[model samples]
Target: MTDQAVFPRLASLAGRLVTARGWKRLGLAALAGALATLSLPPLHALPLLWVAFPALVWLLRGSDRPKTDFTIGLAFAIGHHVPGLYWISAALFTDIGRFWFMLPASLLGLPAVLGLFLGVGTVAYGWARRRWGLTGWVEAAGLALAWVAVEYARGHMFTGFPWNLIGYGWVPVLPVLQTVSVIGIYGLSLLTVLAAALPATLVATKPSWRPALAGLLGLALLAGWGGWRMAGQGLGDVPDVRLRIVQPNIPQALKWKEEAKINNLRRLIDMSGAEGWDRVTHVIWPETAVPYFLSSDSDNPDQAPLTRLLTQIAPPGGALITGANRLATNEAGDYIYFNSLFALTQGGTVVASFDKAHLVPFGEYLPLRGLLPKGVKAVAAAADFSAGPGPRAVSLPGAPAASPLICYEVIFPGAVMPREGERPHWLLNLTNDAWYGQTAGPHQHFAITAVRAVEEGVPLVRAANTGISGVIDAYGRVRGALPLGDSGNLDISLPQRAETVPLYADYGDAVPVVIWLALLLGIAAFRPRPT
Candidate 1:
């Protein structure tokens, strides 16, 4: 009844799992991958990953040919991404009448394209293992490394959709989530895949339970280190910095209606200037809250209404930082439209502003418009949005210098901070999550936003039109908040930045890349010759 003796029996069962062929193997692979999606946000069922990854490892063992391995990996990845990203289709439902044709494309087509990275990555790394009849820890390490490699590439390649990384599974556990401040997300994902997959070693020819024990030890060490880092921390608040985040919970369909535009602004003003209006020093609004162009400072017929609204919403000495559209003539006399964050001080004086540097593809601008069939248009906006130069830290009246991230721009980890100037005191994210209302998209988006605060060692303040608005201190703790689909405003004191910048902020993804290379080297050194 010893550990070594029991595990060989597991090897026999694993052999049966490996013998699955054709339709049976494909179904099991897809099922395992689909189960893994539950490990993502709003669910965060970490134990499912234990089941999913080990099953994938055993399934990968069934095939020796590259074609067979690639297909298995493809089916597995397709299953994983479709469920994890199913919320994407909720945006189409905002105007379902026009976009009904895109349902299958959203649910199946997108995942099919994105999943190729994982499929190819598996074939590349798993090749050596099958060739040498590798087993035990070495084989598990190979699988773990391949998963992280694909995760990294999917995040960086082709506009890069890096949603639901394995690391985010730790978000529900604060102590575990703190690990991102050190190794960054990719490194966290590397350890996550490694720990989760190591149990598969129990099914190796010379099976031993020690590998599973080691995996548990890895989790314990990670938790111990994270617990220590967060141990005596308080929600360090800054002086004279109070913020009001207004969430009107407007529907995406009504947000841009010409008739409802004035009413929308009034709703924002009402929530912003509600009960505790006198005590608030600054007000924040979600992306595209105004819906109409708020004219520049110079005398124009449209300027009067903007000034009146600013007087109603702007704090006495502070400013109102809200999302708006900016139309300006370039040096060549061509008009450029930008999705932007503009700060209006008391008396309607325009102070500081930052245009969104990273624009969302398809949502902001189509990649190759000439290639697409005629009459097709970008889904999110009526006109294509121009990109800003890059990240900028602009000074506000009563708040610290802030870097503005509009909508999906906040999702990118290393790119949120200013590139050249002094580091901003805080991050200001304005988003309208109404596009994917009442779904996991907003919750997942908010989760990713919190991680950036920890990774950059700065407090983050978020305002969303349809909720998940909050103030996150430097440690990623939610100090103040509102839920999805809520109509309200939260009055919160701006939390102080962490005393020291995080290592990941200074080094970026290089921390994880180094760890990946080390794992690759170790796996190669320990490889057994082909049997």
Candidate 2:
């Protein structure tokens, strides 16, 4: 045979193999999305997480078109978000039917929106692979960097919804969770994406044995070290302060009715009275525990009953912190009502109050109110409440001062802290999960609260109406909790003051931002020229 003929035959075989590999890559990407979604709540099938990243890398290999890669990535993100966030539909199940459509709308819409970030990352990855030509370990670095950059954008883009970051999957592993004390959740998320993508490099290219072995070893070492740290760290021996958290479990339908206001107060006082409040130093009630505005004119008739009940439970130094709607006339002559946390002296006097700063969109207040339909506006009570200038820390007379978070405010990172030189002893989150019903929404919301405790290195006392009320320690450990659909009071001990601020508390998410910036710059510098 002629030498030229042999060369052409060899080239043809190589082209066929590459074509087959491309098909394999697309299949793998879809599988990865499905697997990753299983690791999220309602399923929490954990082992699937280990294979998710490897599958993504296999699926994207050798794809020349950036748009194709983006579509594949978007598919994976939709799989992960749709099933995981299905509980958002619970809002529609409430007494109001106006938002019935918003449930499925958000389920599909949120993923569609968030998938854009992954799409951007996939495009950048393809661009980097083409320009760099898989040389000098650059392809592996590019893929890892691209994924992390996408996650960063997911954490910050459009006011940021940092939920379901890959790092959160490690919550079940204590050692891995300890890493948050140094790097924060986003930093850990970056690390997690890189580790998961490392195995893909081996399958994509025939690199030196040394680089491949090193990559695998590095991931093992990181996970091992996290395990070690988790084992060595103690829960700490801080003095435990006795606490009583009340979950009135008030139904959402009756919460705001003028007639039901007195009934609601009686239920809370009766539930709390059963606890024999004498021994507890701090008593917490869930958000909107008081149906009527404490400062409103209609309180004249209800005041007598509330005062009598509060005075009856008046224990010498014990303080009661409960959620109430506070009405006040602003300087502009307009009446302003606030979702507030009021510290009451057993004698029924309002000693201190912290108004909620972060308001839920559509829930607390409708955006572009003038544009909404009349029917929609009528059902939304959140419109009546005005946002308080934020970061309010309530100080009880003799006890430790605490930073109070009302309802949805607990989910925002760094937004929960008091001003400099005013850090509180711990975080108190008062929430009403009744609207979520028996769905995973309450559990998911509570998980974020746990992360916040770890992020800030402060014990979290979460009081929820209709479930998941509990005490989470600095390490994200839930001690005593009342499950969903249960109406009860949890009496536990709060950890003493946390002196050190967690890395997240100090530097915020700056590390993740720097990582994302570096990845974008690297991708731009290495993007391939058009053939």
Candidate 3:
């Protein structure tokens, strides 16, 4: 059999296999979703998405009603997100004595909520296809567009959790991931959905090769361009700055305890001022490294102890940037508390500070504060954390000006860079990954942090309370790192930033927006003529 002859026959067979109804359809949908999650980080089995996305397209095609399509999509999403986000339950385990009962709820509840977006998107796909009588490549394009629309919405709605997006599946493949430098992650996600879903075009009634072949060609072009961009490029020259990332691997349970506070502070101190500090210019501690308020507070006797410890470890003529909590009195005469990044000079004075502008909902502050009970608190801290003005790049002695991202703040694309000032030379991310334990959370978090470097054409220096602490150069390569769940310090030179700002950095979401609009137009312009 020739090449053209075999594909149609295979597609016809796939159509027959995927057209089952009732429990069989639901089961297949769920299986496809579970398989798709294997493609994400820590697994990166990307080939599985070939089977999963086509299965989703086939399921959507067979549905006669929007409700049925929605049900199938919901089943798929639940399978995908539950396994993908099961690591979230690890956070609840830190204080198992208090939160043990919430384990199953955390695992099952969050996925169900997130799946609603996919469900609604599928419903829209069904409506568009049925209303316009779409088929073959047009149907595939429509479904892919709808799927990405939902993904984008989920990424922006209600504090926005964009974890495990399909684009991250390409992370293990450097040439493929380089696309983000031009179009950002969401643009790559759009292409991923389109390519994966196009296989279903072969199974459509028309059985046209145009869409599937086009998708393959597009992917090839992407890889070719990326290969050209990265060809012959090695880690650029190291800058004048050198850093010591302190990963004490402090347990979340012990991080805030009064009795253990001194030990935690001492651990960071000893690790920073360790034997190798004589040449290091800057030292970093993870998010909330200092449990007590370190800013000047005459009324609080803890200030003296805090200053005494920091005085010993502060680098000569350099600064120590660490995560801490700060307090300020507003004109209303009320105290506002913030999760912040403070830069302490050798004299023990905090010369510069960047308060975290984007606060984590529920983790830092309750969303519906009035609705909750009086004494209830957020997960991370006892009191609610107030949001700061916005992003700021702080200048240190020897290091280039740096933008500070605290904890989950680094995860947001197109939102991490400072809004007004000159672009920072490097991104300084301080996070406490200890809350999530040794599960996939830290690994996934580190993966997202790596993407930011490529998107901005700048280096990223990430310090985590547990591990995955490292320096990633502009190309998203890990120059050096401390292993997850280990206590150690990495002494490394900062890699130089890419010479030019990335296309995505300059244009923001415009790339993805243009792609989405073009796909939508194709669906409309190519509607099938009367048979």
Best by TM-score: 1
| C-alpha lDDT values of all predictions | 0.84, 0.69, 0.83
Ranking by lDDT: 1, 3, 2
List the candidate 1 regions with Cα displacement exceeding 4 Å.
1-13, 295-301, 529-531
TM-score winner, 2 or 3? 3
lDDT of 1 by residue, 471-531 (tens): 9988889998999998898999999898888999898998888899998898878877654
What is candidate 2's lDDT per residue for 428-459, written digit by digit as tens?
A: 99998887787777877887787788788888
TM-score of each: 0.96, 0.84, 0.94
- Candidates 1 and 2: which is better by TM-score? 1
Residue 121, candidate 3: alpha-carbon lDDT: 93
Report residue 376 deviation for candidate 1 (angstroms).
1.2
Candidate 3 lDDT, 400-443, residue by residue in tens = 88888998888888888975768898899999999888788888
Mind sharing the TM-score for model 3? 0.94
lDDT of 2: 0.69
Residue-level error in angstroms, candidate 1, position 154 = 1.2
Model 2 regions more than 4 Å off? 1-31, 134-144, 207-240, 257-259, 296-308, 378-384, 497-499, 514-531
Residues forming the 10-long window of minimal summed lDDT in candidate 3:
1-10
